[model samples]
Target: MTEDVPGVMMGFMENWQGLSGTWRVTLVVFVLVLMTAVTAFIVSRLVLWLERRFANTNNLWDDAFLHAVRKPAMGMVWLLGVYWAADAAYRYSEAEIFQANEHLLRLGFIWLLVWTLIGMIKQGEQLLSTPGKVQRPMDYTTVSAVSKLLRAVVIITAVLIFMQSLGYSISGVLAFGGVGGIAIGFAAKDLLANFFGGFIIHLDRPFKVGDWIRSPDRNIEGTVEHIGWRLTTIRTFDKRPLYVPNAAFTTIAVENPSRMSNRRISETIGIRYSDARQMAAVVAEIRTMLESHEAIDTSQTLIVNFLAFNASSLDIMIYAFTKTTEWVKFHEIKQDVLLRISQIVDSHGAEFAFPTSTLHVPDGIELSGLDQQGQTS
Candidate 1:
C-alpha cells in the first residue's frame, strides 16, 4: 500500500508538472470557468424545455420542479467545477494548501446549497398559492402560515449546515440556538402575539380570502386579498388596499357579512297620522311589491304592516329577504322596491312621513310679546 501510494503520488505530480506555467494555469482556470458557464447555459435551456414539455402535459408538480431547477443550475455548476479545479491545483503533498482548498470548497458548496434550497422553497410557495383541489379546505391564512414555517425551517437547516461546515459542534450550536430563541421571544413578544393571532385567524375560519369583513375597531369594509403571518390585507370597495395587523383582527369584532346565503332587508315607511286606512293600504302595497319582486326569496314569508303610530304619521315596517347575498344585487333590489313602494303610496294620495314637533301656547299671547314687537308688559 505504501509503495502504491508513492507511485500514485508520482503520477499525480507528473500530471501537475506538465501543466504548471502561468499561462497554463490561466488557461485551466478559464477553461473551467467556460465549461461551468456552458453547463449552466445548457441546464437553463434544459429546464426551459422541461417546463414547456410539462406545460403540454397539464401536470403542475413537474412544472414547479423545472422552475426550481433553473434557479440553482448556475450556482451548482460553479460549485462543482470550482471545487474540482481547486483540487487539481494541489501539486505538493503539503497539508496546509489542501486544508485551505477543502475549506473554500465547503464554503462554496454551502452557499450553493442555501440558494438551491431557497429556489425550491420559492417554487413551493408558487405551487401552494394556487387553491387546493378540495375548494381550498385550508384558508389562505393557514396556508401562508404553514408555508412561512416551512421556509423558516429550511433557512434554519441551511444555517446549521453552514455552521457545521465551519467546524461548529452540533450540541454547542443547539444550546446557542435555544438561548437566542428565548431572547428573541422575549424581545418580540408583540410580534409573537401577532404570529399566534395569525394562527388563530387560520384555525378559527372567521373570514376567508374575498370575504367582505367589517372591523369593529375601524369603519372599513372590504374583501380579503391576502392573509399573511403578521398582517391581513383587505381591498376596500373604493379599491384601496388596507393592511391591518393580525393581532388587531383578534381584538376587533370581524363581521363577515358576505358569509350569509341571503340578506335580510328591513325598512320602515310612514304616512300622515290622519290617514289610517291609507297607511294600511300602503302596507299592503309594500307587501305585494316585495312578494312579486323577482330578486326576493319566495321561500321566506314577507311581512309588511302598520307597526306603530308617530305624532305626525303612522309607521309601517316592511321586512323581506333578498334571494342573493351579493351587495350590488341587494342594493339594486332594495332600490327598485323603494321606488315601487313610493309610487304606490303616491298614487293612493298618502305621503311618506317627515318627523315634526308641534307646540301649543296661550291664546292671549301674541307675536307682539316677542322682542321685536314690544307690545306686552
Candidate 2:
C-alpha cells in the first residue's frame, strides 16, 4: 500500500507538469475536497434512506446507532480527504512543513474518531434508558452519568494517543499524572465525594430522574431534574429549581414517592358525642364503602374504627390506600371516598362535630345574676 500510494500520485500528476509546485498542490487539494464533498453528500443520502428504513422497523437500536454515526461519518469523510491531500502535499514540501502538516492531519483524524465513539456511546445510553425498551431498563440519570463517564474515558484515551503520536514518552507522562492526580484528589475532595455519591445512587437505584423525592434531613423535596457528577437538580412543586450536592442524598433519607405502589389515605373524622350510639354502624358502613370502592386497594390493609373519644366528639379513624399512586387520581379517589362517607353519616342522622363546649351552672345561689354579670363582662 505504501509503494502504490506514490505510484498512484505520480500517474495523476503526469499531465500537470506545466503547473508550478504550489498550483500542483492546490489543484490536488481542490480535487480531493470536491471528491470528499460528493462522497459525503451521497453517503448522507444513503444514511437518511437507511434511517427511514430503520424507523419503519421495530428494532430501535439500529435507528439509534445510525443517528449516532451519521455526523461522525460525514466528518470522517472530510478528514480522509485532508489526510490524502496532506500525504500528497508532504512529497512536494520541505521536511519541517511536511512533519507539521502530517501531525496536524493525524491528530484531527484521531479526535474525529474519538468524537464518533462518544456520539455512539451517548446514543446507546439513550436507547438503554428508554422505558420498556430494554429487558432491564436504566433510568435517565444513570444512563447520562454512564455516557459522560464513557466520553471522559474516550477523551483521556485520545489525549494519551495524541501525546504518544507527538513522540512523548507514555511512561513518563503516566508517572507525572499519578503525582498530579494525588494533588487533584486532595484539592477536589468534595467534588469526588459528590461523584461517588452519584455513583452509589445509580448503583443502589434509590431514586431516578423524574422521581418525586423528599429528603428527611433537608428541605429538598421535588421531582429530580438531572443528576450530575457534583450536583443534582430538582424542580420543586412550586416550580423553583433547586441545586443540591449529590452527597446529600447519601447522608439523608430520600423519600421516593414515585416508587410507591399506592398512595395512602389516612383520615380522622369526628362526629357529635350524641351520635356515639351509632358509631358502630357508621364504622361498618365506612369499611364496606372502602372495600367496595374500585379505586381503593383492597389487597392492602383497610381499617375503619371508632378509634377514640375526644373531649367533645367521637373520633373515627379511616385508613386505606388507593390503587393508583398518581397524585391527581389518588386525590380524586379520596374525594369520592370522603363524599360517600359523608352521605353515609348523614343517612344515619349523625352530624359532623365542630369545636364546642357546654358550661354547667350549679342549681340555686342566685346563679342567674352571676351568669348575667359574667356574660356582660
Candidate 3:
C-alpha cells in the first residue's frame, strides 16, 4: 500500500464517489469486517508460530510477549474495524449514533496497550519464579513484588496519559492529590500502615514464602504460604491456616527455623552408679563416635562430657548438631546416633539408670518379724 500511495488514494477517491449511498455503506462494512477477520487470523497464526519459536529458546521475554499479545491484538482489530464501519455508515446516512468519538478511540488503544503490558508482567513473573522454568529461578516473594510494582507503574502512567489526553493538567491533579492524600491517610491510617509494612517486608526480607516462622511475641508458628500486601498466610503444624496482618510482623520478633543451617541433637543420658568406673570411657568413646559419625557436624561445638551425678545415676551430656535441617531427617539421624550410643554403653557392660531405692537397717534394732519367706515365726 505504501508503494503506490498516490495512485491508491486517487483510485480510491474516484471509485468511492461513483458508488450509491447504500452500496457505499455496505461495501465499507463488508470490506472492514473482512479486513478485521484477516488481521485477527494473521495475528493468531503469528502468535502461535512465535510461541513455538520462542519455546525452544531460553529467553523469557519473547515467550511472555507472544502470550500477552494475542487477545488484545484481536480486540484491537475488531475495535478499529467496527469504528471505521460506523464512521462510514454515519457519513452516508447522516446518522448521529454512528458517529465514533476519536477521543474514545484513542483511549481504547491506550487501555489495550496497558492491558498488554500488565499481562506481559504477569507472565514474566510466573516464568521468573517457577522452579525448572528458568536456570536460576528468583524468589517468589521478590518476583511478586517486582511484578506488582511494574504493573502499578504501567497503570499509573496510562491513567496520567489518559487524563492528559482529555485536557486535564497533570500538575493540577497532582496538587489535588497532595491535598487529598492527607485526608485519605488520616482516614485509612491502618491500611496505609499495613501497606508500608508489606513494603518493608519486601525490602528487608526477614522471612519469605515457604519459610517456617514463629513469633516470640505471639503464638504464631507456621510455614508461610503467601505474602500479600495486607496479610501473610501461614499454614500451621496442625494444618490450620493463620492469617497475620503485615503490621504485626513489624512489631513481633520472628524466628525462621527454615533458615537454620543445622538441627541440634542435645540429650542427657544417665548410667547406673554401679557403672561409675565406665563413665570416663563412655564419655571418651561417645565423643569419638560423634566426631567420626557421617551425620553429625563436628565443626559446630560438639561436646560429650560428664554432666552431673543424680541420686542413683551418673549423668552424661551429648551436645551435637546434625548435618540436616529437615525435621524428619534430623529425627532419623538423632535416632541412629542414640542407638549407636546405647550399643556403645552395652559393649562396655554398662546399663542405663532408672529410679531405684535401697533401705538400710541398724544391726541390733532389727527384730525378726517373719521367716525368710515372710511367714510369721
Candidate 4:
C-alpha cells in the first residue's frame, strides 16, 4: 500500500498540474465569459419586456427612458461579468496576453459603468419632470435647457475624471487646458455668452413662453417657444419662427405687453371748432360712452378737452384701459368706443372736423357794393 500511495499521489499531482496553467485558466475564463454573455442576453430580454409592458400599462415616459438605457445597461452587465471572470482567473498572470486582457476588461467595465450612470441620470431627469412640474408658463423651455446643460456638464466631468483614472497627469492636463482654454474661449465666445444668457433668463424671470415680446430695435412680437444654448426660438403671431441670439434678448428692451393683466387703449376724437361752446356737453358725452363700455376699465378712464384747435378741428382725446390682455379684444373695444363717440357727436348736432379752407371776398366788395347793399336792405 505504501508503494502504491506514491503512484497515486503522482497521478493526482499530474491532474493538478494540467489544470494549473494559463490554458486551464483561459478555458475557465472562456466559460465564464460565455455564461456572462448569455446572462446579459437574458437580462436584456427581460428588461425589454418589462419596458414594453410597463410602458403600455403604466408610465410611458419611464418606458422611453428605459428604451434609451437598454443598450448601456446590457453593456454594464457584460462588463461586470468580465470583471468577475478576470478576478477568478488571477493565477494566469504568467501569460502576458491574459494579464493585458484582464486590464482591458477592467478599463472597459469602468467605461461602461460611466455610460450606465449617465443613462440613469438622463432617465431620472425625465422621471422627475413627469409630475406636472413643467406646467408653468415658461417651465418647459427652462427645464429642457437646464437638462441639456446638465448633461453637458456631466460628460465633461466624466471625461476628465476618466482621463485622470487612466494615469494621465491631471495637473499637466489642467495646465495644458489653461493655455488652450483661451483660444477655445475666443472661438466660442458667442456660444458661451448664450449659454450664460440662458442662466440669466432663468434667474431673472422675464417674458415667459407665449408672452408676446416687442423689442425696441425691431418688431419682435412673438411667443417664446424654446430657449436654447445660442438662440431663443420665438414663434411670431404670423406663425414664422424667429431664432434670435440670446445676447440680443439681454440687451434689447422687450415690451411684454401680454404679461400685463389688462391692456390700455388711448384715442383722440376731433369735433368742429364752431361747436366749441358745447365743449362741456361733448365731455359729458365722451365720459358716458367710456363708462358704459364693458371692455374698458372704468378706473383708468380719462376724458379731457385735449386740444384747442388744429387746422380746422377741435380734437378731444379719450384715454382708457381695456380690461383684457388680448390685443384683438382691445382693438374691438377701441373700435366700439370710437363708433359710440361718433354717434354721440352726431346726436348732439356736432359734426366731425375735416380740413377746410375758407374763401371770403374783401369787406368793400361784399354784397355788390354799399349802395346795392343798402337797397337790398
Across 84-163, the per-residue lDDT of candidate 4 in tens digits comes to: 56554544354455456545665676676567666766665665555553343335456565668777877777677777
Best by TM-score: 3
Give the range where candidate 1 is weakest over 10 consecutive residues by summed lDDT. Answer: 1-10
lDDT of each: 0.75, 0.85, 0.87, 0.72
Superposed Cα deviation of residue 361, candidate 1 (Å)? 10
Q: Residue 55, candidate 1: how far off, in angstroms?
A: 1.5
Descending-lDDT candidate ranking: 3, 2, 1, 4
Model 2 lDDT tens row, 1-377: 43345347646876787987778777776787788899999989999999998898888888888888888888888777766776777776745665676677779889878977887897799779877667777767778877988998999999999999999999999999999999999999999999899888878878888899998788989999888878889999999999998888888888998999889999999999999888999999999999999998999999998888898789999999999999998899999999999999999999999999897867775554445547733
The RMSD of every model to the true structure, in order and in angstroms, is 5.6, 3.3, 3.6, 8.6
Candidate 1 per-residue lDDT over residues 110-226, each given as its tens digit: 766667666676676666666652334545556666777777887788778878878999789999889999999999988998888888888888988878899777886899998
TM-scores, all models, native as reference: 0.80, 0.87, 0.88, 0.69
Residue 308 in candidate 4, Cα distance off native in Å: 3.1
Off by over 4 Å in 3: 1-27, 93-100, 362-370, 374-377
Structure candidate 3, residue pairs in collision = none
Between candidates 1 and 4, name the one with more favorable lDDT.
1
Q: Which candidate order results from sorting by TM-score in descending order?
A: 3, 2, 1, 4
User: Which is the winner by TM-score between candidate 2 and candidate 3?
Assistant: 3
